[model samples]
Target: MKKIFVLDTNVLLHDPQAIFAFEDNEVIIPAVVLEEIDSKKRLADELGRNARQISRLLDGLRDLGHLHEGIELEGGGVLKVELNHRSFLRVQEMFGEMSNDNRILAVALNYHLEEIEKEAAKQVVLVSKDVLVRVKADVFGLKAQDYLSDRTVEPSDLYSGYINIHVHPSIIDEFYTYRFLSIKSVPGASKLYPNEFVILKDEMGTSKSALLKVSSDGARLEPLFLSNEAVWGITARNAQQRMALELLLNDDIPLVTLSGKAGTGKTLLALAAGLSKVEDEHKYKKLLIARPVVPMGKDIGYLPGEKEEKLRPWMQPIYDNLEFLFDTKKSGDIDKILMGLGSIQVEALTYIRGRSIPGQFIIIDEAQNLSKHEVKTIVSRVGEGSKIILMGDPQQIDHPYLDTVSNGLTYIVERFKNESLSGHMMLEKGERSKLAQLAADLL
Candidate 1:
């Protein structure tokens, strides 16, 4: 049966094109939701961009028909802006004050009651990204759901970027002897992506094994180009780390992604490889690091300091990893090292847009906070002669509108899996400390 979906302000802000995503169903936008979106149209961030896009979309729809009344959407759905349904007094009696959330709830409640009076068969559902709004809808005995049209992959079914294949014992021996084996030589080697890593073990339970990666041509599997090599005095502590280092140190692959939980060494490994390429080998002109400025909860308001001082708290984790790499004992030693090199630049992801970056090794940390459009903008700005690394923990997302499946990090990993110029690795083991590993596993 066709359904009526009442969208919250956050649903539109998360994806401006959500109106056309419901197919043949009817989409309702309460007037209070538009008020909230209008308030956010002036900020200079991803949210503001989305808000502006939604405004343009609604304005375009005005030419076809009045939004107060229903209009037919291009995708066979009906879109309407519900102006007369803002009965805040009725909402205040059930839930308290007429906040924006409660006002949105009122629209759903009004529609549901009217539907019952008309004996309609269509279901009325409230769609939102806010957990509190969904819970309050339950209090009113209304059906509520999360918007799932843009989700690309589930967290539990996320790609690990590598797999283990059992082969004949001679295949492993031949891989070591010849240093490369045809992909057809493996029994279960069908449909492997380019630059994907593999662990080749013997099917007879022999102790022979090899770590190989699919060639760019997808016709052969070659031994890892780099093995146990130290990058900035940091060696791989496990097999997954070794695979990540291989992908990081390769110049031919321009894009690399790493996903792991806290204490998994994702940031450390990326930073180490970036430093090695920029400082030691002079392969790139500079080492650039940036991350989104997402807050855990409510923001702390404007910061008070110079540019670098204001960014200190947000970039401290990068600085900590750099300090460990340089082995700085003094408090100000990291500053001295960066000054002497004159090639390291750390900035927030806010200023990265509208600029072309070339001849640099770029690392985007905490990338899970970015949206799909935001990540596309960042990657499109990559000029020639540059390598970009996106690393993040999908489980620790701070963006209120994004979850593990819809965030930028997971989106890039899934979209670029088949590309020949990109490689991905999911580091499983935590090499930071024993306590940190235990906390990550149990807590």
Candidate 2:
């Protein structure tokens, strides 16, 4: 049965191309949604960019037919800019204020009433990204749903980048002796991706095991190149961290992604490998670190001082790790040390747009806050001889429109799992401290 989907303003703002995602269902854009989108088109951030894109898309659709009445979409549904269904009588008593969300709800309510009056089979559904908006929709006795077309994978089904395979005990001994094992030798390992880590366990129920990574060719599993040696005075404290370091230090794998909880050392490990590659190995000319400026709690509005001063609070986590790595004694020593190094650059993710970064080791911290489009823009900016590492905890997203499965970090991890030049590892253990680990697991 053909359905009628009333889209909220945030749905379009979250994804400009969400109009075509309903697949032959009639998509209705309430007049209030357009007004909200127009209000955001003048900003300078990703939201503004998306607002503009959606506006232009709607304008282009106008040429085909009258949008106010209805236009046949390419997906076999009708697209309409609803202007006459702004009645708030249905929700005026329940929601007194004629706010934008209520206005959108009013439009959906009107359609639902019309459908009932005519005994129509078409289902009227309100699609939104806001939780409260959906709740309000339910209060009006309307069917509401979240816009979920952008999610690359379900949270439970997200790729972990590592798997354990139970094999004959001799197979582990063989891997130790030859330092190489073919994927065919392991049962139920036919679907492994390139560069995915594997733990070969004893099939006899023993604790013996061997850690190996799938070769880039996806043909065999090989031993890790890096031994127990420390990278910039930081060594892996757990098996997953070791896997992350292997991917981080390998120059052949140009793109690496790490996802873990707060104190799992995602940022610390990336910074350590970046420093080692830039300062010791000389493989890259500079180390560039960046993170989104999304705040955790109520924003402090703005800060006083220069550009570095404004970024200090957002980049403090990076600075903390850098200071520890450099063994700085005083508070201002990190700034002086950074000035002396001349090879490390820490900046906000905003400045990274439209710039081609080459011959540098780039690390994007807290990448879970970024949208899929934002991640694509950042990754596409990588130039020749550059390596980029995106690390974050998907479960801790701060973006209003992003969730655990829809953020860019999870998207990249799942999308690039099959690529030869990409490697991913989800760190499981937190090495920060026992207290931190306890809080992460229990609280």
Candidate 3:
């Protein structure tokens, strides 16, 4: 049945076209939401971008009918700016003068009151990205929910980015003798993506072992038993990282996002995959690496040189990964090679806007630093034949307004999971060192 969805400002900021996302359902934009959008439009970030988008969208809609009176939306339902809900009599009694949250809550409360009096009216649902708002709605007896169309995984299950599974001891011998095993018919076997790791254990739980991916062909999956590879040299002592690597290196999975402690190898394996694709498979034209210039609570105000020089302190991690890939003694040597071959480019993510990139293996590290708007700008630039990977430790996120759950890494993971043009893994292992892994767990 069709219903009315009251949109909070945060949902629209998180996704500008959110109004249209709930197709055929009436999308109600509280007057306070527009006010919020207007206030955010001048901020120099994602919120501003979304504010502009909403402005443009509302302008486009104005051509059809009076926005004050509501317009029939395409397909079905309506889009209206709720004006009647501005009556602050009840809200002022409880929360006093019209604050933004109270005004917005008043709009929802008014809708609830209308539903109570009206017969045969559709149910009113409130959508927000704020927990407090949802709680307030519950207090007012209005049906409310978090706008979770963008949450990728549960916080408890995020797992630095890995998973592990166990199989029979005989299966292990089959892996040793046959060198690989297929789980198509195996009961309770995970539908592992390519490059995901599996900790095969005996059915009776006697023995445990690890298996990596070679390829994915439905039930006829192939295994890469190369435990000797440096990538797998660091064992996933915890089940979380074991799950994380299973997600990271899977070739069938073309995109990945990783977040953990500082040394969790989020940048390392992405560089590894980008290197493998560029050097070994010739699958992409170049490995384009980028990350937001958000300093870890420190600005580069007094840095020397141009914007490029200014970005150096922020991009040192990219250089570090490149140094590892080239096995070079100095960053200067790697720069020379990158210049000669033109197969690698490391630069600020800011230039990604208004450009379409094709046939490239792209990695956006530290993605949690990006605002929801910045992430959207980067994603819309994915041209044909390109794969974009985003990874970050959300727990250590640098964006002031973004937490582990609201950051772009998790947002992309949730958005792209079911798409055929995309596959994603979350790498969880700390290949840097034992101390690093210990710090990730302890600290």
Q: What lDDT score belongs to each candidate, Candidate 1 first?
A: 0.90, 0.91, 0.70
The clash count of every prediction, one per candidate, is 0, 0, 17
Which candidate model has the greater lDDT, 2 or 3?
2
Q: Which is the winner by TM-score between candidate 2 and candidate 3?
A: 2
Model 3 lDDT, full chain set: 0.70
Candidate 3: tens digits of C-alpha lDDT, residues 394-435: 777756456777677777766654443344445455657888
Distance (Å) between predicted and true CA of 422, model 1? Answer: 0.8
Best by the TM-score measure: 2
lDDT of 3 at 418: 41
Model 2 residue 350 CA deviation (Å) reads: 1.4
Give the residue spans of candidate 1 off by over 4 A: 86-91, 117-120, 295-301
Off by over 4 Å in 2: 295-301
Best by lDDT: 2
Worst 10 residues of 1 by lDDT: 292-301
Q: What's the lDDT for residue 443 in model 3?
A: 82
